[model samples]
Target: MNPRGTRLLAGRSLLVLFMAATAVPFLSLFTTALAPQGSTPHGISWPSHPHWHNFVDAFNAADLLPLLYSSCLIVLGVVPICLALCAAAGYGLAVLGFPGARLVFGLLLLGLTVPIESLITPLYYQMQSLGLLNTRWALILPLIGLFMPFGVFWMRTFFQSLPKELLEAASVDGAGPWAAFRRVHLPLAAPAVSSLAILLFLWTWNQFILSIAMIDDPSKRTAAGALGAFQGHYGTNVVLLSAGALLIMLPTIAVFVVFQRHFVKALLQGAVKG
Candidate 1:
């Protein structure tokens, strides 16, 4: 065989192997979700007593709506606040040259190295002092603080990637720093901003430890906390558990799908072109 022919065969085999490796896990999960707990699949395997109602039944039993709402509230509050601050900080670090910029940014990276678990106690006490514990604000404020350093670093890197001459030209044309940032820089960084928001939104939504620690109230628990509420002393309801897991993932998946309008190509295009 020709050298090129051998290489083509190798690439095809590698592609198949990669696809199978990645896809099989998700396929197994979907199958498990559709199947029963311990019943043998004697005849049909698709679950004809299909337990289609399990989805709503499991979710509703979990008192999931308010938990879902609490999560939404937390993400909604955290993402925008973090984005603006991070973008501004990043822009400063990237575009505005200042003494100790590296020091400040390096410190942020340092903050990133410290896990959120390390600070939960101090954060809880701080929230207690502010009368914010067990409230959505408790979740919101900490999420913003914890997510900030990375957000700033990301936005700063994006801002740095832009041409300096653009900002200068805008300034020469009578644009102030705020105006340049808002009208010019912000528009160009829309994709980066959107991408960052997507990531932070998901992280805040899925945060389990903080939700469990901060919200001791049943009514105020986040989605992950609500899942823990589903267990019994007898045994785990695999169906209900899986269903809850699926529901929690639904909003996140929706966010990604919806934000593809503002993300995916836009972010990639900005990164590649800029």
Candidate 2:
């Protein structure tokens, strides 16, 4: 076999290994969740009598309904606003060639280095000062701010990869900057926007720390945040805890499964452009 064929075989084998590695934990969780309640199941053994009711019990015990609603509310509030702001900022920085854009972009890039853990205390105080604590706004507002750096960067990179002639062509046809952005670039950016939306949704949904720090009520907290309290209450019950975990994970998994095509397409587009 040639060197290229050998490398292909090796890569395929590694990919299979990685897929299995990623799947094992979730497979274990599923089997444990199905095991008899209050019973400790080892490894990934199938239960002789699956306790499917564990899921229902876990849902009720964790009060997941309200938590799910809160998560959806936060996601709805964050993703669209973040996308709009990022897209506009990206367009200005990458395409408009405005003065001092480099300095502004560099400042925003610094935000990517600041850890969320470090901001929690300051954010808590800020939210309190604004009287937004314990409300959905506590999560919604901070998340938008926190997500800006990476979101802007993502959209900026995509915009920068496009040919500048596109905008010039739009200008030749009597379109102004806003018109060019709205009619030309925005349409071309659909894949990038869709991909960014998926990422924002996942990040917002799985935001555990901010959700826990900002909101006192478990019901108002994001699904991932509520898991801490749920585990605290049901920590001893491995079966029920597993069930609740799977329930918390369901939304993210469902979302990825639904929009995975867009995510993959965006990634492929980036690779090809690069």
- How large an RMSD does model 2 have? 1.2
lDDT digits (tens) for residues 43-149 of candidate 1: 22466556666677766777788888877777778888999999899888888778999999999999899999999999999999999888878888888889988
For candidate 2, what is the lDDT?
A: 0.93
List the global CA lDDT of all models.
0.78, 0.93
Clashing pairs in 1: none
The TM-score between candidate 2 and the true structure equals 0.97
Per-residue C-alpha lDDT of model 2 across residues 97-205, encoded as one tens digit per residue: 8999999999999999999999999999999999999999999999999999998888888888899999999999999999999999889899999999999999999
TM-score of 1: 0.86
TM-score winner: 2
TM-score per prediction, in order, is: 0.86, 0.97
Evaluate residue 64 in candidate 1 and report its C-alpha lDDT on the 0 to 100 scale.
82
Candidate 1's error at 197, in angstroms? Answer: 1.0
